[model samples]
Target chain A: MGNVPAKESPPNSGGRSRSSTYSGSGGGPFGPNGSSSSARRNTTSSAYHQSGGFLNGIANANDKRSKKTEEKDRLHRKHLLGLIVRYTENVDGGYLAPFGTYKSNLDYNCDIVRGLIMKRRLAPFYTPLQDFDESWTNEELIVILNQLPLHSIETAYSNEEEEDDIDNHKIHKSTNFYRRQEQKAKLKELMLQMKQIQKEEENKYLEIKSSSSVGQRSVELSSNDLLLRLYRNATECPICFLYYPENMNISRCCLQPICTECFVQIKRLDAHPPHDEEHNSRTNNDSEDLPHTLISEPAHCPYCASSEFGVTYEPSLDICTGFGGIKPGKFRSVDESNDDAIASSSTSPSPVSPRKAVKPRRKSSLAINTPGVISIDMIRPDWEAKLASARNKLARKAATASAIHASNLIMNADEDSYSPSDSRRNVGSSALSNVEQRMIEEALRLSLLDEEERRAKERREERK
Target chain B: MAALPKRIIKETERLVSDPVPGITAIPSEENLRYFEVTIEGPSSSPYAEGEFKLELYLPDDYPMCAPKVRFLTRIYHPNIDKLGRICLDVLKDNWSPALQIRTVLLSIQALLGAPNPDDPLANDVAEDWKKDEKRAIEVAREWTAKYAVKS
Candidate 1:
């Protein structure tokens, strides 16, 4: 009975190992070419190297057995990759599905929508501030849906590939040509299933609308009036304590409401500093340190503490995206429909401007690439670079201060460029005090060094 | 200091209006971030009769990070050190933004009722509690009477 020994392949080990690359100055700055896929590839190669070494350790293993074992390992690897692809699609689909669509697919979407509307809870295209559950005429639901941006629903379809597409890219990179073709075919099939489900949900929605007697009587309010009502009954974001319209961005993990302003501000702190093990092993004894590239941890949901903090936003149905039909920086008047809202959505530029008057919701910009969800990292794009530069500036200041004090005898050429007065000015109000403090410390350190050198010379002479 | 965030103001209002049953937290006039807190130890514990004082300060990144809380009243519990620093998960890694000051104070009161010797801040106290349970309880009671008692 020749049993294939299980290969210890942990998925998160890649994330853990890749932490140092982005974490600080150690792995250097992530240039334009350096992305997550390249980092992931490094992990795959390292995994292969480990297995190769394991195989080498078996001294008496015959070539036939080794080749057979390799075949088994390849199959095992293929199985693992398949699981990853399926898992990514499931999670992404689950998030993309309209809130409550997961209960029983397309069948219960209406019930979930009704339940959500009754609760006066925010959902994609179903944000109702006041409960009209008893008076929830099918016409009212249609009116509400029509008024709010139903175009954002189409935005989800475009984003369907999002993370799964990225996973497929990874799968393509990891596998052989045949495996790549196989995985691509499998992904196409999965995508078709998703599309079919989406179509069924749309059909269900149409059927619901056709059955309703919406045509018999005219809907009372215009889109603008509905927007005004939603504004009047705005929900306050807990973090910023600011009142936003009913169609506020919903936290992906806990479904708690958050305004775009506060949601973007929630960033991951650098919890894990860059480890020097890889750097030390790769380089010879060079005293100079590698520049640390700041890697940010995924922000946790403020309400739930669930990691990979992200938000799902459904664009508000009116002239401007929801939250009282107001953008964060630009406050638009209810009646005034201008180009300012479009200009203000500078964070996320969407080619498909649903309406010329409607300013796309900030998250809708992200909706194309990420689909339904926008992670904190995407919310504050290039945050890692900003953080790294900020840390570097602080480190440079500290380095100059220490260099001025410590290396009085052997000053580097760069020391000439550093002016104490310049640094003092940068230090602001405490400049004079800081200079005085540094001067005193410098004097003390110099005197101590001179004294130590003289004592060492005398000791040397005595030994001779 | 920048103007207080509205969330803090709102939280403070709620904390004052609906004060926790056995816990009271009053913000200082000069620094609203700093609070003077007192917790009446849980009933049926060694600290039942004692009134424990604690100082809690919310950092700039409040809610994102846990509040820095320290005991002003010395506690003789395995989880509490002589300096009154507590070894509690909520005060550290297990803290969630969903948790409020009210919830945290409630947790502290609950901690008094149950002293976890397995994870201790004060090693000697934990050892003493583990080795001789009755003696440890008596000592805790004596310390509570000596230090935590309100004159």
Candidate 2:
């Protein structure tokens, strides 16, 4: 009787090789133009490439094969096919899942996932000294990893395909009839809009150039502007990493613009007496912002580590787009900003006077007095206020599901009874859970409402 | 997350444009947080004339927290252990958010110049240095030549 050889289970390395055959279908005969159908064709070609193994020879042998042997061989092939399918399905899931949060269809919290990570951790190469039960599971590692601000993994499958999209613009050069027309039209429209914006900007610039008292004064002004722009473009604040448009505070040690805002913050941190012992504590408490990294300071410069760097504010702060900004030398001294306003008022022929900024914060005019005294207020930074702001930011970022649930319950509270938001007024301690924070906020709201209602009742009695 | 804080990017850019003397730091292509660093020992120190390889990793909360740094090259120093871990104030409790990559590396270079045996990570080396300073220096110089020199 002719007997077929029994097939063994494929090991991991063999499984990997088998799964890679999925990509083999990508470069098939039918897809001259790349399409999903080409991948399907590739799969068929790959299957065709694998000619029947020793089984065919065994079947062709000039002896009648026992019915039981034939049945066993058929069942073995079907089982092997099922295993291959499972392996391929997993490979596909890994490639398709969004990076970080690899939320596949499979239940991550299930025992199967726990078993898998356990197996990985138990491997001989893994750390041998760790307390096994206390250590984080693979699921926890994945969750924390996903929480980290990082990008998706570049799977071999997807990365190769994205490169294809770049050349999807083949229609612009080749005028290929097969290429989608709507996409090309959208691209053309986008290009036209960009050109239009460029043209408008050029025209506006020309008008400004023409209107600026043509000839000698204009040339002088333009040269001044060029120098200012060069300086502004080259110099960026070392602390904030923003270009110096205004209020440049150059450190005496490094001579780099460290920005007044950052310096002020540094000064505030300096004022907070150093908490020496807390540095080593690994507690997950947010209130202390995970223990301050700094110890004692005549607070050193971050760049040079020099304690002697005195901050010198630039004379003409850069043109500040907002509060705490200064675009220097753009109008001469800080005082020139106001003068330019006056100059424009005198020369401009337009009927509509440009609305002057209301509640302007920085008066470049005030900056004329150099080496302003470092008042106690300036040197002794407000540590509490800074901490409050920092605490609020942490609370916002760390909001969990429970916190939202608590907030939702508070939503049921009568809006009429709700007083002004006390949540906005004060920052809670970092140790409070999101749920606790929401509850505190609701309580604060209720108390405020009570006060308002009492005041309203008093007014009604007086009117009666 | 929040795009690598602008301050970090600025620090990295300046590192490339105007590299520090006797030191070089290049960020890894895969992860910007990881840096492959090379520092030349100070001329005055026992580590002088030797090039040290170090791996520096900026954590997610860098600037707010101290960078994780480990020496790759073997050396004989009181403050540095066999595991390549360093015992320095600036890299630990004394760290400030104000400190950057340049400042931290400078602090490490300074640590090499002034090996404080009293506050040492390698206890055995520290004991040797305290007992016989001259003999300890000899061992350090030998190790520098043996392990640190490329040739």
Candidate 3:
């Protein structure tokens, strides 16, 4: 058979000369019978020489293949190194996003490394390649790399490109457009996430609020958290120094929120002293007459009471008392009884003027022994009269006791030096001791005779 | 978020952990760039026994720029005004990148010990110091005893 003869021809000498001729003239074209002719030449050549020719062809093809592979490996290494350097150095003058590039490059390198490991090719350079997971395949790594946006990689390259000439401006502009679009997409995604989180927080707050009692609701309403937030958001109403909600009667001209009391003042500026009859009549026909009537007078602000006023329109019912003469319930006249009491109390006393009644009480205590001494007479007259009567009795008793004690002491003195006549003379000395001794003795004898005659006459009349 | 200036973050960390003696700086947690500091007066000066508080703020470009330092605790130094604003060359014109928080604090302590009366922030205090050193020192000591002492 032809196959048997061809198989045996490899051991012949004819094939050696044909193979030599073919090598000497590189890649010559053969005729249609070339296969048969070549097989016949191949059979003539010895088996050793034929085997040598086959070895030479295999070696030549391997050399070309190895050279091409080495060139490709060098290029891949250069690219990988460039990526590492750019990411590590952040070579975009600090403006570029190295993180994105790093992630992408990491994914790409992982694929290449993973492919080499799976094929057992990495064993030569990385000895433990067999231990790595086979599931970490190249295709999986490539998917991860593709997931990273293209603009990010372009950004890495553009940073280097910026150092080049202005002639590259068109390319730079196009890259910037792509970068902006990528940034916008990223920003939108972030915003959506943030909104979701905010919504969750708000729902949580609502849940807490709903579970609470009315008392708790009031407590929550008045809590410092809410009050502080309101205060921060609300500028002080220029009129009252208190915060007015934005829904209140804010002055359009000044952009200031005014209290209802101040809002009245602002609305009445045009109506001061009453407008002309013609103008009043024309404006009075409006159905909202309550606001106009209440705002007729340019009233003083209860707070500052400044007469200077301006105009305000679009006053809300909650904030303004009189809007188109429709008086809100909050603006009714305040009760003046408490105010009157306060005014009276404040005006009643002056530090400079002494109180008349208080002065008398102090003076009477100081002048206790003098007439009008006890205005205790004024406070309690009966008690004062009884006290005075008791004092008179005390004085009489003191006089009698003092007189009796004096007589007892005098009586106890020496009897011989104290004659009865001498005592009598002493008692009568003031009236009769101016004359001589005989005249004093005759006067004493006559005064004794007259006293005895009077006594005898009174005794005879009593016996009859 | 705007990226934190790396230089400021690094320097601030160092300043907090390894602070200068007689100076204590504590930045607000809510506002990392604003700091409150307390400086103890140096010994051998009229201001001794004093502990003055200061407010410092790192601007956005800090490290590239110096921080703004003000005396919140009133001081009687010639270089500090009644409003508690301090006038120091290092804070304004003579700032250098090499200078850090520790160095600035030391400079402030030195300023208190040896005031620059010729270039004064509080003119009255400076005038008193120039006219009568003893009186100025007495007043400074009195202020220290009254206002700055811990007790």
- Candidate ordering by lDDT (highest first): 1, 2, 3
State the TM-score for model 3: 0.27
lDDT of each candidate versus the true structure: 0.50, 0.44, 0.40
What value does the lDDT take at residue A257 in candidate 2? Answer: 53
lDDT of 2 at A92: 6
Off by over 4 Å in 2: A1-234, A250-256, A264-464, B13-17, B93-100, B149-151
Q: What does candidate 3's lDDT look like per residue over A108-132, in tens digits?
A: 2323322322222211010001011
Model 3, position A113: C-alpha lDDT score: 28
The prediction achieving the highest TM-score against the true structure is: 1
TM-score of each model, paired residue for residue: 0.42, 0.37, 0.27
Candidates 1 and 3, the one with greater TM-score: 1
Q: Fraction of reference contacts reproduced per prediction?
A: 0.18, 0.23, 0.00
DockQ of 1: 0.07
Q: For residues A1-464, what per-residue lDDT tens digits would candidate 1 score against the true structure?
A: 00100111111223212222212221123321247546755643443343443335333334543554455445444332221111012110111123210111121123333233222232323222222232333334335534432112332233222122222223113223334456556555654555455556455545544444455222212232333334434576666454545567778767788764455456666433354233213342222233354344677787877778777655434433322233321323344322343334323322222332355545322232355576766534445545554444333323434534344422332354456776634544354345445444533443344334334534443543
Better of 1 and 2 by lDDT: 1
Q: Candidate 3, overall lDDT?
A: 0.40
